[model samples]
Structures are given as structure tokens and as C-alpha cells.
Target: MILGRSAISMAIGIWSIVEQAVAQHASNNRAKGAPITKNVSMTRAVYTKLLREKVFPAIRKKWPGRKTTTIMVQQDNAGPHVQDDNADILEAGQEGGWDIQMVSQPPRSPDMNVLDLGFFLFVAVATIQDTFDTDGLIAAVKSSFAKVSYHTLEKCF
Candidate 1:
């Protein structure tokens, strides 16, 4: 998952054996100053690749001319994001064209990361309220997400 907080907006998705989670994040428009908009995906390698290659690139295109610095926060899962094959991503960033930072592992605390709580709230609020069919639930989740006004996000800080 791409856990970040900044002026620019971001997106994230998650696919677990039990369920799939997706979140679209934007910086709070009000006073606390603009924070990085983080796009995160909580999924295994296959899904994460789908999001990174297909989804992220498409979304990245919308923000033309914007420089994107990547920082990966990985949990102890066996996925491409955590595999050696993906080292090139960090290497590419270290090549000096873009800023890259990695969150430390081992003893890492998810609570310390704002995105952690953000993601939790996103999932909790999105899936709550009532039971529905697949499509209906999808609509409910989207509608719930839409209802998260700037005021709610600001309170997260």
C-alpha cells in the first residue's frame, strides 16, 4: 500500500482473501495546510501489479507534469512489493530523478502512520450501514466514501 500524506492526492486499493478494499484519497481543502494525497492498495502481488501498472499509470496521467516521488510501506507479506524483483523501483528512484523514501520495517508501528488510520476509517465507514448485494454494496461504499467531507478528513489529523 502507498501510505502517504501530502499536498497532492493519491489512491489505494486492497484485496485480501476475505474481501477487497479500495480507497481514493484527496488532501483536505481547508486550513490545516495541504497534505499529500495518498493512494494505497492492500493486495497481493497480482492485484498490486494490476493497480500499479494499469490503475496508477492511468491516474498519474491526470496529474500531468507533476513529479511523483515514491515511498513504499510494506507489511510482512510475500508480495511483489516486498520481493527482491521490485528492488528496481527503489533503485530507479535512487537514481536521483525522483525522491524516494522507504518506511522502516521490524518494530514498525502502523498507528504511527496517518495513512493506517485513514485506510481503517475508509474501510470501516465504507462497508458499514447495511447489507446489500454486490452491486448495491459497491454503490454504498462509493456513496459512503463520497460523503466523507473535508471536515471529516481534517478531523483525522
Candidate 2:
């Protein structure tokens, strides 16, 4: 899930859940060897596209009346996340004369991330109560994200 926060408001930018699929082969009515599972982890390219295509647009739509055009995006310190100098992200931020900056969270500080400590927990609880397949799980998680209150997110700060 992607979220935007400021002094006055907090909004969910993008919430997505992807499933990993495994390829299995049957041999003589028995399973043949181990299944090959495709990696579903987020990569730098995917994150960059998310920032450019999803987060930025949400920021613009949600905060069009804000006084400042500069938006600072705080991201977790993950290997797939983009650096501050990513060319595509920088260019996207510069669209419509807005300044967009990517900021990394401090190392070894899980509590510092609002999403990890708060929103994700809510989602996990909401999802855990339901019995759903992969597609259903994704839908339920997205619905749970929408159900989260902005006040709850604000309290995470």
C-alpha cells in the first residue's frame, strides 16, 4: 500500500497485493519434482513505475490545493526501491512544475515507518478473519485498506 501524509491530512495512494505462482508438472499421475515458483517481489523498476504512475498522480489529485508544490516521499530502505537520483522518477516529479523528492527511512528503524507498524497490521487482521483464495485475498486487502480511517493513519505519525 502507498500512503501520503502531511501536517493536515493522510491519504492512501495505492494499495496492491500480488501473488506468486508456481508451475507444476504432472508425471504418470504423480507430481514431477518441485514446482518452480516465479518471484513476485517488488523490484526497482516496479517501484519507480508506481511512483511515477500511481503515487504522484494521487498526490496531485489529493493535494491540489496545498500551498507547497514540493512533495517529499518517504520510502522504506529496501533493495528494490529507487535512489534519490533515479532519472525517471525525477522527471515525473518535475511534471507540472512540481518538485518531487524521494527520502529513505533511517536504517534499523522499523517503528519509524507508519505503514509497517500501523496500516499493515490493520490489513493483516482484516485479512486473517476471511477465508479467501489469492484473488479474493487481494480484493479483501484492498477493501481493508479503503476501510482504514485517515485519523488512524494520522495517529501513526
TM-score between candidate 2 and the true structure: 0.76
lDDT of 2 by residue, 43-142 (tens): 8877787787888888887778752667777777889988888888888988887786777778778566765677778778878866444555666667
* Residue pairs in clash, model 2: none
The parts of candidate 1 lying over 4 Å away from their true place are 1-3, 6-43, 68-108, 149-151
The top-ranked prediction according to TM-score is 2
In candidate 2 the C-alpha lDDT for residue 155 amounts to 76
Candidate achieving the largest lDDT: 2
Off by over 4 Å in 2: 1-9, 17-39
Considering summed lDDT, which 10 consecutive residues are worst modelled in model 2? 30-39
Q: What is the TM-score of each candidate against the true structure?
A: 0.48, 0.76
Please give the RMSD of candidate 1 to the true structure.
13.4
lDDT of 2: 0.69
